[model samples]
Target: MEDELEDRVLHQTYLSFMKIVTRLTSSAPHDTPVSYLWKMVRLYFLRSEVAVITLGIILFIMYLQTIEQWSRTLLSRLSQAMSPISSVQRMKFMEGSEADKQSWELKGSLSAAYAIKGRRMHMEDRFIINENINNTGISLFAIFDGHGGEFAANYAKDHLIQNLYNKIVEIDAFKEGKIISTPTKDNAEDKPQEPESNTSVERKISFKKSVSTADDTSKKEVTDPELLAQLSKARPIITREVRPTKPIKNVPVPLSSYLDKGKINFGKLLTDEVLAADRLLVEAAKRSMNVAGTTALLAIMEGNHLIVANVGDSRGVMCDSRGNAIPVSFDHKPQQVREQKRIEAAGGYIAFNGVWRVAGILATSRAMGDYPLKDKKFVIADPDILTFNLNDHKPMFLVLASDGLWDTFSNEEAVKFIKERLDEPDYGAKSLTLQAYYRGSVDNITVLVINFLDNKVASSATQ
Candidate 1:
């Protein structure tokens, strides 16, 4: 009886072990050979509760890590995409119409337009139109094409005019054989002009603003008459009839030196102001931790002089009435001999990814900001200045545009294109920008079209 009871207990224990194996194997997947292997694993682990718990913890940790990495990647991409959109919203007013169809006239001579955004979210370009500067028949128009960011371009548009105006004021005072006044922040606006003749009646110079709307929107001409009138109202008049009781101190410079038409070195003056602007922009960018730069192409039309200044690849072209295309500014590129030499001297290398670029990053050797490359001095902000006496040539109009328009269109081609649509300055610029876009230009485009034929002084130079 004792042997039979011992045998019965052993049989019951074996039955309990078999029942656990059957339950675990029943739940195991068996759809393929791999599933058969899974079944074997389930059987082995079923015998030990600790082994199963260990595997469950390992899988849970892996799943959490995968979720965390995926979340991070998604957020990073989303932030990059949305950041440009917010920037776009902040600059809607500055943007040109869809395809840059909108046109506004500056003074009576220049007609300008901004184009549609290319691949960029924002235009990444800014332009300026200040007519009748400093009681002089001078008009200032500029285009700033930005890269990496728009801060540099916008900053230039806002500040370059004032800086240049101050410089002009100082130079004019020097040319008049007068004592240079202490350069004050607001001197340009307050400085009085010397009398051109001995007339007792002071001549008041004023700019008139006029706006005429046409049936066709493209034909509308917009002028800031109020601004011009205000400038006239602010003109300072000094009584030259009653000489000062105190003897006046005059500059010792020869009268002939001041009388000579070519005495002023405008090119040097322009270069200095452009570099100063770059320094200011670089410092501002550092404070904000923003890395950005811009290509500047500006034109100042004063009397018979047309002064063009450039820092990067944007161009200024003057089309003569004889249909000749005169290049006012040349593109600044990394591969150019002068630029390459400068880059090498500054310990920077030019490499090609799509096109030749400075340090395999920036394409232009000269620009406004690009603070990362500023220390190396490879990418500079100094401008190439060109002075043209508009009277020397039969000037018809001036075309200033970012690289986007020039890359696909040659200088001669652009001149012909504009000449065909010369009747409509706004439409001409817009069409040219669109042409470049359709021709596969992958960058932002901005164009300024100034008609010298409209101004009576310049009309004599026209075809």
Candidate 2:
């Protein structure tokens, strides 16, 4: 009975399979692709479970590959949005230096941010920190804010320190009678001179000519401390290089004497070197076919003296022990009376577009390059120099930043902001820069913070 039942079931199954095959053949006049598909489907069902697992693994891998491609595309787009081809933000840099003779130390950090215009450009700002220049204990720190192009700023960063050092070498040579003539030409007539008026908006600068640029349009500002924290991690502008040194020569007097004698005329030396750099820039621009401009703000600390030289709008502010903000350098705007006189005297007019600009073009009255304007004899390369005796007023730190930072934070406000973060010297400049960006500054931003509070000269006032 069992055998008969099994035979009947097998016969019924065979009949059902034949009916399916017959229907498939009758539905198509000729063998169609669908018939092959149906045969494959039937084969698939007849296959073992291992085949099904294999197919599932293949599908999973394909899905993963698709997801990976999508992620790469997303990352590529994000990177492009962060900066333009020419202006990618560089990593932050931090270094430390101590004065040779004074009981003070300097800590410096630099970082760059993209401009609001959103082009692929480099950080047009550059800086230098020589811990022990020629091991003289004289530390040099500077920031160059470039506009129109990065050439000027980069050039200044690479050459400015060496130029200043060369000037000092000449001074030493002159003192020792190794060279009869000064390293710089005694071309007082050719150099710019300060007006006798002490009330000039900024100090009377030397070697200036007329020029013009547009000022920034005011915008609603915001603040971003978080952004600043992130910027602090960027790589430095340039790797620290061995500072070029002038070979030690016979000295008629101690090195200190040469630096301090007759106020050492160090201020003049600085001015001369600055003008020399500008000339070099002009010549370089002529060759490159790219005329660019940059603002320079420099601080030189030798023993008890802190000297500052600035061109254009970048600023250097010193915070005293009492937390008072001291303007070591001033912004050179065409709208200022002294700057205006100089600009007009050079045959440049200050036109007002969104803000006061030089000849309806540049906003700054002084810059290192701008050869086209320089050719017109309207824009000039000159700097304002100020000297402070750190012995008298105990200092806490120094802030050197481009106009992007000054556009948002005031002298006092910035000093106060830094004062609150005295514990983290490196973060001082980073925080200020972030604040400027959050405040909606459209220009590229760069900041250098040098903390004096942590030096051996910690003042009771700030403490």
Candidate 3:
């Protein structure tokens, strides 16, 4: 009805204007030029009620057209801003000095960690410890040594584990503690296996023998804790070299019987979880996390199974009952053959600047942020995951630390130091961190020690 009325009104107004124009032109021969213009206006434009409706409708139409154009423009801009392909928001550097003067500590009945600024002016290191995940007998521990800034470390400290857990419980089997049984030999292909090598070191559980990876170490098993401690103090001190090898991909080791009261997948889907967490960080690094990067080492202990995922040069080593060190995770350095190949494949290069560095900037070839390199595929956040049955090592405790500690302390030296201080007030975490600082580590120092004594762990807060 309104449309019809509007059309009729416009049509009548058009006919009226033509009629008035024809009349004025014919009648204007008797009037002056100025008077003729006034007569034409009075006949149509100033025609009172009809003229008001016609002018009002025309003005309203103009307003509607303007609003329609504005709405379309706004919608188009919004679509471009929100589209994934068209949008690449960048992170901005913060103002003022973020260089920190800080030292920190975290202590629990079963775990403890310590950190300090060391020789660096800024403290860009972060750590996390969640002794129990939803009371499911699962514990989480991590250390992130950040570079460029603290943003990436902070982001991972806050979100990494949450991301891992969300990925873990996605399946009903894991959620209900009804994970499927281990695959049979006939179907062993269901899980990928490590490339076989005769030199592979397989850990075994025996308190009578301390598991040692050194080829030159004595074969005799030391049962006396006191004697082992005595010999550890007298043993030659050396940094253990990390040789990256293909990770063992299968094992629902029979040790699971005593490790847990309930059956849950033994770190199943953990690799996917680590990859998922890094993927998220990469996106954040590209957008808001800035160009900052961090070395991430996360350890999950469920029952007797200990699974570790690592990136960058941060280190993790487990001490056996006999006080020897067994590495749980290997470092990813640019000089590694595989790492060099990947960098070369991506059209990037590494250089030695005091230490081997990726593109002469980052010391490690793998990290959680470092957008400058991650974007170029020279540095990655993909974790090299390794799993171990704590039962096999007859483990005493685990020491996970940043490269800052590794810079000053070797695997053998650190294991011996911590084993001697495990019963101290800080459980060796604080002592080891101070030791690294005194030994002249140039980077930020962080150390985490987790004790497996009595099969007990705790949920603790960082201080």
Candidate 4:
């Protein structure tokens, strides 16, 4: 019976061991840790969800970085592109218009405009130069517009006013040589008289003296009556017979024909000199091709004189204290009828757009550069200079601006707005620029406002 029990126990233990083996085999295929880890890795990889999630995160980060890099690059490029924006500086003075007549006080403002975008590429625009030399009431103001590029405008801006100043000084020097002379009575009475003393001469002298005395008495009677009557009338009508029967002969000189025949080569030397100067500057500037250009309008107040110079379509408008607008500068464009006619007369043709265009090349009637169109005796770049006399009755303010500002506002509108702002103590060019932007002026806008007041000291004290 004991042996039977041991066998039965051993059988039961064997059955339990089999059941444990079955359970382990169902739960896990392999007993090794490596095999289980390999199974888990295969299942995870097969699902694909974690790998896709990781890849999506990496791509999103890359995209965000790319966007950020692009934004920075674009902003940098835009800023670089606008590197040539112009700057303005101004100076105000305390002086009146006249010296001896100092009833009204004088005040003036001067402004300068400079742009440096493409330093190599010159832009031609308007500029102002004001120089108050001592208290001699000598001042100069000028405007320079560059066409075909900024080089010519800059050259003119630097030199034109100086030349004008020199010319004025030269004129003053020439006027110092006029002298007047007055006649003296002592010099007119120095004369000699003859005396007769011979016997034959004595008889003749007695007769001559009697005749002389009678003639003198008659002359005195005639002179006294005529002088008294002339003085009483206070007006005299003198008539005299004058000879005028000669006809002037006309002689035609064949100077032009002589020049054509090479008899006179004066123009050649002049042309060479001009060409040499022109070439030197062009080569120095590294600008053989006339690719740079600008337009300008400037008004300067020197004492009581208003000088206006224009090179392009930019303009200057003057307004009375009552806000009446007056154009001080003429627009120099080919579209103007008078300018078109002038260009055609100068052996040039106007383009179809009604502008003084050269072979459809330039829009302005006159400009500083455009080497291709510049000819020795035909195409010239002389700007129109005008002058006006400023007086008390015409107390005015001036508006100088770029095309951008003019495009959005009319002369009357600009004057009105400026007049309203003039009362502000700290008003400046920046405020005007902001107003232009607010008015939807998309292009770059610049403005200069000059106020001329009667009471200089009182005006400043009040401010």
Per-residue lDDT for 108 in model 2? 30
> Per-residue error at 26 for model 2, in Å?
86
Candidate 1 structure lDDT: 0.66
* lDDT, candidate 2, 7-58, per-residue tens: 9999999999999999988886675799978887778864778678889999
- lDDT per residue for candidate 1 within 1-463, as digits (tens), equals 9999999999999999999999999998668998877888889866678687988899999888657745774797687667756766735633433334232333344565645556654456666765665544556678888776566776676666556654554455555545343332322222333433432322333432211112121122222243223223323321112221332233232223322474555666667667766776776666554566889988877678888999999998889879999999999999999999999988777878588987767788899976667755868988888889877886887899889888899999998998888687473887677678768888877777877766644442232
Candidates sorted by lDDT, descending order? 1, 3, 2, 4
Which residue pairs collide in model 1, if any? Answer: 209-225
Q: After superposition, how far is residue 305 of candidate 1 from its true place, in Å?
A: 1.7
How much is 18 displaced in model 1, in angstroms?
87
Candidate 4 is scored at a TM of 0.46
TM-score of 3: 0.58
For residues 193-310, could you state the per-residue lDDT of candidate 4 as single tens digits?
A: 1212221211111100000101111111212232223223322211111223233232322223213342222223223222332333332233333233345454544456566656
lDDT of 2 at 322: 91
Instruction: List where candidate 1 sits over 4 angstroms from the true fold.
Output: 1-108, 173-180, 184-264, 425-427, 454-463
TM-score per model over all chains: 0.60, 0.57, 0.58, 0.46
In candidate 3, which residue ranges exceed 4 Å CA deviation? 1-101, 167-268, 457-463
Q: Candidate 1 at 262: error in angstroms?
A: 7.7
